[model samples]
Target: MQGAQRNSLRLLQWMMAASLALPIALFAIASTISYNSTLDIADREIERTLDVAHEHALKVFETIDRSLAELNEVVRDLSDDTIRSREPALHKRLKQLADALPQLKSAWIFDANGKSLVNSLASPPPNQSFADRDYFYSHVDQSIGTFIGTVLTPRPPYQGARFFGVSRRRSSDDGSFIGVIQASVLPEYFESFYARIGSDPGSFFAMGRTDGVLLAQLPRLDRDFRLDPNGQVGRSIAAHPVHGLMTIAWPTDGLERRIGYRRVAGYPIYVSAGLETSAIRGRWLTTISQHLVFGLPATALLFILLAFAFRRTQHLQLEAAKRREAEEALKHSQRLEALGQLTGGVAHDFNNLLTVIRASVDLLNRPQLSEERRQRYITAIGEAVARAAKLTSQLLAFARRQTLKPEVFDVGERMRSLRDMLATLLGPAIEIVTQLPAEPCLVSADAGQFETAMINMATNARDAMQGKGRIVFTVHAATSVPDTLAHLSGSQTLKNPGFICVTVSDSGVGIPAGQLGRIFEPFFTTKQVGQGTGLGLSQVFGFARQSGGEVTVVSEVGQGSTFSLYLPRAPADLLPRSPAPTTAPAVAGSGMSVLVVEDNIELGNFAADGLTELGYSITLVDNATDALTELVSHADRFDVVFSDVVMPGMTGLDLAQAMCDRCISVPIVLTTGYSQALSQDGIAGFELVQKPYSIEELSGVLHRAARVKRVRDGAAE
Candidate 1:
């Protein structure tokens, strides 16, 4: 045993270690992947910036080259003396071409002697000698096509800003080198344009010569800058020749940067754009740290939980014993709690009804009461009894044990019928709106129960709105259960192909979120004392579930609330093709006999007395067993057996079954205020009338059942 225990402990430790390591490993892998992705994004952004700069540089250089070419054509074979003779015309033309481009500082035509013959800046031309200039000397050697010179500030005699020249060699038809026609581009113009195109701090853009001369740069240097011949940028250019991305420490600031460089199509210049390496890394760190911020705490919490679990495992046997005890205690407490609530609610509602009845009875006993006052008190007593019956019915409904008589009915039609009733119930202050589908939406449910549920919901809505808002009734067909009710709509409970939604929406003071879940509880109410019974929504909830559907609610405080009752969709064929024959009022019992079975003596005597006055011979039994014995012994005497369903011994349903077992043929009619047995098993082919039924209703039921029995008996004979 000791060895086994030791091994178990070791296994648990290993498992916990593995659990802890797994997430850390996965997190590390995810962080690395995310970092790489961030870096790749940074590189791409830099490359795009480089492309923009490259295009700008290419356009500026192309304009200068074209302008220089056009000037070359003008003085292709002209001698220096001839160019000087037409200097006035050439100077004006040069200035016009130069001024056309914002980047260009000036344009010039020089002769073989290296002296400016015509210049855009001065109409008569400056006496400037460029014989010693690198651009001129380079062109003097042979026809170089285009010569790009290094950046230079103007000499004292020629006062101007720093600029670089883009010159084309003017050669004779014999291929002899002539003076160059040059366009001077302002470096500061490129610098200013680069500034206009926004870039992050530590980011830089530069136009440089492939030979490593930096012509113009944002974050301008104190003097001209150049790349080392063997540096990172120089080597990358050599390797790629046209375009590439690189990371290098900038020579000016010694800050590391990730750069993208592209060479101009036919020029010596390369345009590069870069973001500081530190900034790129910082962004990547921020992302990873954000993940860590959440990941670290979660991992720590997991570790703590594991440690607690390990500690608990050491006392597993002790905890198992304690947990069982706690659970049993908890279950017992919950049962008591539920019973207490049910008992309290029942007592509270019934006491109120009894109070009204008691007060009305006291008033009726007045010695000097007038006939009108006496009649009013009687009416009040009757209403109180009816309300008491309704209270029990609602309680049964909330318990999901209300016996229902389901029929296929069109929800749209029912809603249409309720409009007048709703208007009267809600009063003139509340507006009612109906949105019904054009097609009939049929549902299989008790029509009376559905109407009651709707009324309950509407009353709740009216109360929620404080009685001055709009109530909308909408009926629509749905293919499946709503998400809110999906978990509760089990397969056995809801096995229908479709459902119909009867929704009641109101603009009112909405239910609070904390109270929503408890709103359906039997005794739970947000209303103040005497304002409500708190069983209204409970009844709606029960009716829907008992009818193979679900009820759902959505609300926001101070806005409104919506309640939807979903029922199984019924096919049109389920509805009777013809209307059921209405049972006419049976004013008299006509010498018929009824065996009245009721456990309550007062109710039994009342039923017997009422039927006796209706010309029926009544045999009253206090229990279903005695009723069964009476049916067996003198079964021929009773035309119909009227019995209360809920009794002390054999229930009305059982008694009916017993008579059928004995092959007794008598029309049995069952009635109940509420019965769990009838709710679960249903009426089993017997006529049923709910309790507190009127004399006219009971008489009609007896007549119908006895007539059907008589017809069947005649057929048998």
Candidate 2:
């Protein structure tokens, strides 16, 4: 009996050890698999991020090239002027060119004798000794325009640091070489390019000249964080090891990190992605150590438990945890959706208030006020109004409700206007190039919105370039519709349809592949807080969509990025634009009796008071029912019936029809802020005007109504 008991105890001890070994083996396999999977995911994420940065950098380069090209064309055109006789006209032309091409830091024309004729900067380089410069000598040799190397910190009064010189030998009308016309681009213009290229949060992107000089860096690391790639980082990149991953030991958060880097294609740029290995694997290591410490006692007790039951319970617990996690994720998504809807609703109502304020301020600037006092009041009101306008614009931009009045405009002309401003904005470390068609290619879109979009894009590009690089804006017509855009309206059947495409590209550090899709989403930015609002691309997207067009982006890691805005063509007759009207006549009643009907009491009273001041006898009532009642009861008492289109009891259209039914000859004017039901066909005989109208716009509409009423009465007589 004693021997049998001893055998059973030995067997139980062996079973306990075997059970312990099984979990240990399983843990080893799981840890290995998880570690490998994590490493792979990290590697892939880094590669995707690097690709986006590269593509953004390429866009920067393209933008700079385009700006240079435009500057070159301007220089070549100016060369036609004779040196001595056309100096004054040449000066004006130079200033015009400077103003037209805001991207050029300073533009100057030099005589063969090296005398500067025109300079757009603070002052021309004194004495014009640029004959010794490579640009001048090279142009003299080739007798063709040459894009010479960029200048860093050219002499004052030009305190600029970056300039691309495009010089062509200036000649007399007789075609004799007289001097050189050269334009210099500044770095500030390229800052927008850098901003876009290096917009990633954790990652920093940079571009280098062919000779390996750092041209720009995005996010601009602190002096200590800024790596001198020519040292350890550069050597590692140059080596091109297998898997293209380099783990460098660098100080980060009081601990060292393993940095990974890859060189971008088609540009002399290197992108580095890094994370502290200790930070990543520390928890797992600690967990494993704790498990080992507790393993011995747990194994000793394993024999007493039912092994099958224990394994089943562990699996059930994991399932329950997964279910809980899924529920949490679902709840989070719902919360976000609810928040978005709330924000959108708030933005919509805010826009209506802004419109009312703007119109009211415009009404306050009446001719009755003294000029001096009016000016002061106007200045104060205008400033406040402008500030409010900006806020509302942002809100509308967020809600995508801002009005977009599209018109045909020349893309080349608009780009020219932005050049000088861009140069001044980009500073002296970057070059801007523009490639525009000589003949105008008209696009049907809002010129102001288009320009603002370009500025936003340029600002993004400038950020990508890190204050030093190149930005190019190229204007070309799209030869074929892209497959991705085929499903979009107006693009399905496009077979060689000519559409104006404005491409803003940069040669800064590119954007990452993983982040490209989210860039246009509002508030989804890769920039640090307070550094960006992330509304730029969203506004660009809205503007393009509203204009019956589309915007497309193409990017690659380390190669740079290109953003193309495709605008539809306008009819030929609409190509030439008339100046916008800045002023309109106020709605002053010329002693004419006007009948005003509106459901809203405040709006009705305000309209009546405004018309009374405008020399009109005004009668006010609520609702279209009362308006029709007054119109029929007093036929000759009112000259015109002005009724709000939307009313409680009846619509303005209904009131007008009823007046006609009663044989009333008074003219009816319909007004409303919103008229979903009143179609053009429905309101054919009645004059229609949008609500929230100024006294001037109202007076003008009423005046036309009175003229029509008089003609009708004469016909009846």
Candidate 3:
């Protein structure tokens, strides 16, 4: 029996070892796959950056070539004597051409003997001889079709700024070598343009000749630098001929980079661009580290639990139950943690706004305050209140309980109108690209909130790209939310509806995988402190869910991110009709009798006094019960009921229902700071004006409600 027990122990030991080994092996395989995938993604990004640089360089070269050709036309057949005769006209023309093109430093027509004929820099052109210049000699043999010469400083009588010439051979009818028409291309011009594209550290842009002479480079070198004929760029150009990508150590700094090189279509020039390999590897390492941070610990814990269960097979069921209980407790704690974060974030923001108002009020209360300072303080107070209101609105949005005024409108039209506004907001550095379909994509949603959500998403994209890169807005129809987002919270609304998907895609440093799940959570941001409030995406998520749809995102670290906002489609019949313009007199209380139901004494008094001032005969009550009693007893005396939604004994909605049951004819208008019932079920067909309303707003709503009541009573009569 003892020998059998020893055999069982050995068998259990083997099972535990095998279980741990399996998971460890699987982990190893996953890491390997991830590493290779990261490298591939890096390569693709390098190639993309290279393509942009190549196109920009090609345009610059083409501009210079065009200028040279235009200059060639004028001086092609002109003899040295004739050119000198028209020297003043040629000089003015050259100056105008150079001024027209930002890339051109100057334009020159060199004589066959290498003497400067009229140039753009000076009239009665300087007696400079370019016969000794390489450009002049290269064109002497035969037309090389716009030869791109090496970088060189202009000789005496001109600025020392380095320039490379784009020269065309000015030949006679016999094809004899005559003179050269050159557009002096400023290398600094290209460098300045490159600086605006992006400035990621360790990233570089370079233009070089096929023979390996460097023309210009960003992160400009102090002294002229040349590339070896067998260097990475030269070899890559020779091997691929047109465009390709490779990894190499930069000759000047010895920093390794994943470079993409492309040869200009009909020029000997090549453009290369890349980010340092170290930066790419650093991003990869961060992703791997995040995985290990979570995965390793969880794996170890899992292995421990399995081993413990194997050793205590008799108590396995009880242990399993305990483990389940622990998991439940853990989930509960996580929920509490989220709640705490929400509460803390709200409190912190509200406190800041309140502090602003409080300080402004204190300053205003001083009797000796200057007129300018008083106006400033008042303005500050108003702004603070506005900010506070916006914050509460955002919080309501996150809770999916904000009161929205939905209307059926074309989404495409709205975006078209909003594009220019967004362009101004994001600034000139960021490019806004649109892919709106020709057909109108109509939806029933709050147009104001829709614009706000679009702006929020665009602002987030701008931040992710560090104020530069592309923000593409694509609008299309989707039968349903993507399957990948079907399991996300608040996505059930999108399951059975045809939706319009508005996608915002950005090419920026992307979100980390671990943080993607929590990005929409209120007040949770990846941006550094003071940079973001983290409520932008939360509002987006809330708006989508509230509008009967969902927002989904797909991101990859180092590649960029795309956010898809789905909004339910409106039926064709729901399209809004434009009503004819009316010249009716402005709405006012006009002695209309109003029964005001407000629980707060001060607020009730304010309403009563404000309405009285606006020509309304007001009856104020503390609760819906008293208001209902007064209204039922003297229903004919009051023309309208102005009531707060939340009150003691009976709510405003309940009071409205009671009045309806009793066959009361008074029109009821409801107001609320916030009400879950009103937000979820709406005002039950009653006119609603939000809380802290102006006297004008309250009077207008009251007069409109009374007018409708009068019209209905007259019709019944």
Candidate 4:
């Protein structure tokens, strides 16, 4: 037993040593490799710096060459016989050319005798002769038409310092020589270029001409336009023709630098760049050292603690795994709850769509052909279309696709408008009463959605009454309620601060006690399947919640049901409500050409035909793609583009953008069956008409569109 114990102890010792030793050995090797790799990278970076300097020098030379070429062209033009014959015209052209050339400080033309003809300066010297100047005399004999000579300041009216001259001898159509046209470009332009190239906070660059004259230097040129020739970098560059790099300790800052240099291939200039090596690599080295200094001891302690804590962690991990399983189950339950609510909302919208279609078809089947009969049929179709629009709206609401156009509207006014509809919808047996405050009770919400919710709740109440009870609708302004009932009804349970409340009550069969909890569970209904899809209460719940409020029901099986809705109140100043238009205005077509862009072939054709019949000229296109093509090809042809908002390939918004890109200024009227898609951003500067609109609505939108187009066009003119 003693022998076996000794062997087991020995094996454990070996295992601990092996685990700890491996990482330490690997870390040492890794640190060595990293240090060497950083050195190699530094070398490559020095090479790159040299290449960059060389490229910058070449660019400077190219700028000089281009300036010379431009100057030569101008000089040649001034010396032409055609320009000289028209002396006044020639003077204007010279001034214009001088103003255009940013690199040249000034320009001048001279006769063969070197008398100044025109100078860009405000005043010209009485007599200035450049006949003895090198630029003129050197090119005087050569067949070469142009020459870029050594820099020399021009005589009076142009002189301040030496300038590079580009001179050309001009010949007329008969090959007779004309006076010399010379242009001088200032050296200060090249100095500015060098300044920009070396503007980096840590860098400086300087250039020397082929003859060892410094043309430009950053940190400003000295009196002789030269960098400190005795400096280590300057001496090295002047001595070596081959490119070179070296790390030097900057004398002033005490920071190490990587300095590099290369001679520009075609130019006589040598370029140099220096970057602070310590600034670039010091931080990284310091970080590595910090980790190494602390890590060794920390790692040793961690290994010891981990071995001691192993058994405890094993027990805790088991418990944690079980807890995670419980959480997953809870999340699954939440998902099921959300899915149930969604299903109910979808069913409600589908039923509403079916109701509209059924009503419309029934209207078309009317047998009598009297004028009154035809009018009634048309009205019925209109009502059905309005209902279908409501169905799509509800679908969008359920999907969270609808954007609310919140405006302050008086709750009382909206309720008053529905009184007649309420009477007919409730039938003769139910007594409907409205109790509203004389003062407006206003709330911020989409007026249409709010009205629809009210109608839905009223209809549900009427059904529950079974045609023989009194229903009361009341609106009031209220303060916060206690949390107890608030929690029960899921009312804005936090704190109302203040609110507007609308309540609808029916004295009839109330919801069962057991089923009250599931009243908003969409499709969970006691009614016959064909009688109702059970989305009424669900929609009420969603709409109330989405509008920053809540809907609550208080019911007793034998008594009655009361459904109260809470809405956040609007400020007093925001309470005004616009009255609904009492009657449709006379339909008058604006005399303007209209382009109808709709992807639905039948709908597009119907709209075109209908507009034509209403006395408006119409052009029809199937989609935004074809519409854009037509606009591009014939931009001035259309006055207004009446387009469906949602189409395949390209949306109406895309078409609008394309028109703007092409600078085609025309009014656009966007129409859609899906009003949810016509949010604030979609309707900027354009008129929006809901789909299934009557001829009157179409004409109204067209008139508005035409007026807007005229105003815009007049402004342009």
Candidate 5:
């Protein structure tokens, strides 16, 4: 056991040491590889710099060649049929060519004896001769139309006017050299092109002949340069004939450089653009080192921390255990936030309902009210109660606690019904457009859920437009879902042959591409705080899924957004559609007995007193438990058993089910302010009266239950 304990200690020590130790070694290995990558990237940047300089140089070379060709033709005619009388005209043309080609230092003609015959500046022909000039001497040996000569140095009396020129030999028809027509160019022009590359003092460009004669360089050369194949520029040109880039130390200056070399395609001239290699590499290394410096300390610190953590593991575990204890509290806080949002919407809606109810009641209390106005007020109260009940059901459905009540319905008709409310909510700036079909496609879905989903979609569209744009609601029948619509909503394959497609579109600032996928997520609104709780789209998603449908969206930055909802079409042999309800006269009950079972004492008293006032005898109980005991004792006393769906013990639905099991005959009526029981189990074999209903609606429901009981009893007899 002691040996095993010693091995365990060794293992723990290895675990603690290895955590940071491996990373430190790996970083060292990576540093070498990273250094190479940095240099490789630097090489590409240098190559790009060379490309720009090379392009500018090529254009300059082409212009010089063309200018020399044009100037040669003018010079060839200077000694022709236009003789000494045209010397003024010839001189004028020469000066014009020199001025036009800014690179040219001068344009002139010199005879075979090398005496200046005509000069661009109209200076008298000079007595001084260029008989010994290398160019003049080259014409004596070589038969030529145009010949490029070595650099000219002014000799004897001709001094201080140095020129680098390309000459055209003025030869006779017999091909004997007459003289040379020279277009002399300056060295300073190449300096302007070199300055734009960069301000690195070591970087420079040189113009040299392929034979390795440095004609001109931008930090003007003190003496001519000739490169041997063994050196940098020559080696680069030898490897890449036309264009090349390479790095090597200069034999003359002893400076190491990354040089770009290009040979003038048809000429002996070569241009080399060079940058000192160390300058670029230094910058790259500095940048890379900065990154490494920042990360290396953090890495080493991490290694030290891991090694130290060995001693603090027990303390960390205690902290982790404390964190686990706070998990439930965090979850409770989240639930409270969701509850707050739910209550806010519910309170706002309930206030509107109460306002309608209070207004109607206040109007009814007027002593001398017209009969028409009285009936209208009653109708208004009934309509508001029905609306409130449906709204409550929709909230429950959105919460995923209610079983959907699917009915065959037309989407177009529903959209038409919502226009008045939507217009009022959207305001004058927002134009509502409804392009529904004359005969809407039929789909089976909970009417309340469908209405809620439509309203949610409209609300989102209004918000997206910032409350001022066109909102288009379209309803159409589709044989199958298109691929485009499927991407935003669901699969292309329709389970049924066809579907009822309802689309809500708006011309507004559309959703961003990144946020589109998550818009349906609960509490993820892009709206400002307090403007929205982010539950609108979530509720729409819930309603669509619960009703066996789906919702999709398509949008662009400026174009706007479209939301398409696809619901499975109802079958041809769908059940007979229920006719629309008409306002029925509120008739008082004929002393009908009602057993009112409610958990809340205040609610129970309200129910009992309302029934008593409605010409019905009432038997009240605080809960279903007491109501059940009373039913057992006096089973034949009540004509209708009325109870709230939700209770402390034994719900109204449970009591109704128990009565069915006991073979009781009284008709049951269920009611609630808001209860999942009505949605989950449903009001089967029972009348349902949603809460916040008027006295008239309650009277209607209680009487209906009594009638159902009386009819059943008569059938039994």
Candidate 6:
């Protein structure tokens, strides 16, 4: 019996060891996987950075080549009989071209005898002959359109500096060699252009010839006119493709580096951009060290603690749950960071707005205020209120809780009306063009909000072009819409239901692709300080969502941007419609009875007071239950039921449904600051007024509601 007990103890010891070993192995595997994933992300980030640089450099080179091509065409034209006969006229034209093109140093014409005939410079180079030059010899027997070559020294008249010559062969009408028409571009010009890109420290940004000659390098470089083909870099270029990225040790310094190269198309030059590998991996190495400092020790300590608690099943389960819990914590941290950023920016903006309001109020309280000062204070108060209202509207839009007053109108007519306003706003430098269709393209949306978005777009374009460019507004009816969406659902839908698209296009610097996803985020501005509020696009987004529509943008850097607001089409109205009135006679309210239901005590009191002051009898209640009770108890006392849409226990929508079920005749008018019912289209059978309504605005809406209520009461009777 004692020997049997010893065997059981020995078996149990082996089982315990196996259990501990399994967890240790899992921890090791998980750590390795996490490290590799992080490394992959770092590599992707580096590649993306290289891509941005490549695109920017491409644009610069294209611009330069375009200018050079323009001159090349002119030089080709100079080979004609009419132009050559008027040598003086040709020289003047070449000088004008050189003056316009900053990169071109001088332009000259060489005769069939290789003698410099017509020179662009005021004082022409003396006794210039190119009989021995490669450019002259190369083109003497050929008809090269745009031949590029390097110049080492002045072969007489070229008497200034080492430069690049972009030459075209000039030929006679009989196809005989008539020498070369060439333009000189100094090496310093290309070097200065590369210096402006703000490359990293110790990394080289260079423009080199395809023949392995480095023409220009930022941070200064001096080398022989021709690079040695026997060098390591020359061999690498020969071994690699025209454009590529490579990681290798520099033969000159023995430092490991990552290099990117792009061969210019239709030219003999290429650009190389590189960064030291050590600099790229510096942050990654730091992260690994931090993991070693904290992660390894914590992992070991947790393993030991688990060993002690091996007998407890609950403790093991708790440890198992912690992995998922940590994942959730990481997601929560990201959410909190975004929230924190928004709140911090909003706080600063609100403080500035409040300072204006506070100062204006203080000034108004003065005992003997002059009329001018009082007017100034009042204007200041009005402006501050307007700005605050716009700020709140933007915040509500980003949160997808904004209220929209939708109406059917011709978007084309709206753009026509805005042309003048946009012109003044964009100033004299920007031209405003409207492409309005002859027939009406009608859409259902808040006309005011749509107009605001147009104005915002115009302003943004003005800034993008530094107040000099063109803005075009195009209105059209689209047969097919790609989607309709609220913020959370990234769902896609396709249909031919159709939509009215109002596109605002600008000939200005475009938004970066990386920032397109965040352009609608509140308080996120690319503009300089004090130039913008960053709420413009967000308000447009909010209006689109609230009105059951969508917005999209297309942009390319250096090209421009286009913002399209697509609104679902309304049912086509048959009769000719009257235009929306800018102003209407004020409607005063009589002693109409109203029941106000609001959850917040402060807001309820404020609403009650405002209604009473507007010459209406008002009764206020807290929740939907209390509101229902009041309506039932005193049915005949109230003429209009005014209720907030959001409430505890029973919501305003639920209460509305209950009233309908019970067959109550009184008309229901819903008011909401924000409600899920608003976003999901739950307020179907009532009129609504957005928050921050004044006594006059409230009175107007109340009078309209009372008329409908009276009609309902008469029908019931």
TM-scores vs. true structure, each candidate: 0.42, 0.36, 0.40, 0.41, 0.44, 0.35
| Candidate 5: Cα lDDT at 398 | 41
Can you tell me which runs of candidate 2 are displaced by over 4 Å?
A: 1-371, 379-497, 504-509, 512-552, 556-560, 576-582, 660-663, 678-685, 715-717
TM-score of 1: 0.42
Count of clashing residue pairs in every prediction: 0, 94, 0, 0, 0, 0
Query: Could you give me the TM-score of model 6 versus the true structure?
Result: 0.35
Structural RMSD, model 2 = 51.8
The lDDT of model 2 is 0.64
Better of 2 and 5 by TM-score: 5
Overall lDDT per candidate, in order of appearance: 0.81, 0.64, 0.80, 0.67, 0.72, 0.69
Compared with the true structure, what per-residue lDDT tens digits does model 5 show for residues 330-448?
Answer: 43443344445445656676788889889999999999999999999999887877777765654554445235778887777777766755665566688999898886577888876
Clashing pairs in 1: none
Superposed on all Cα atoms, the candidates' RMSDs to the truth, in angstroms, are 24.6, 51.8, 42.5, 35.4, 27.6, 42.0
Which prediction has more favorable lDDT, 1 or 6? Answer: 1
What local lDDT does model 2 show for residue 33?
Answer: 75
Give me the candidate number with maximum lDDT. 1
Q: For residues 28-108, could you state the per-residue lDDT of candidate 3 as single tens digits?
A: 887788778877987777677777877888888888877777778777767889999999999999999999988888988
Pairs with steric clashes in candidate 4? none
**lDDT of candidate 6 over 1-717, digit per residue (tens):** 345545654555555675557656865675677557655654554456545555655554455456555644665646435445666776787788778767667777777767766767744435556766665677887776666676455554346767666676777667788777777766666566656553545465666677866666654565344655667667777777476667766544567766667776677776776666776666455666676687667666766655554545445445646844764464344334333434455566678779999999999999999999999998987777766665565555433423466777778877876564455456668888888889878777777677767766666777888889888888888755654444313322333246778888898889999999999886678987756656667767877777667888899999999988888766566324684552354454478898888898998898788778767888888898988888788878888888888787998888888889888767788887667767777669588867755555666777888898778768989
Candidate 2 residue lDDT tens string, 1-717 = 345545655555566667877877877986787676656655666677556655655554444445445534555545433443465655565666667655566567776766676666533235546676655666654466444343445755546456555455665567667677677754455445546543443344444443344444444432124445575555666676322675555422333444555555544445454445664466456556676677746765674463544455446556766755764564344334323433454455446545655664675656587677656656665555544444443333323323566767888887886674455446558689999998777887777678668867877787787767888999987776566556663542353245788999988678898998898876677777655557677768888878767888888767778899888765456668655563586855768999988888888888888889989999888888877777778879998888998877688888888888899988889887656566324576788776546677788888988998788778989
lDDT of 4: 0.67
Off by over 4 Å in 4: 1-368, 390-407, 412-439, 445-473, 479-498, 504-568, 579-583, 586-591, 675-681
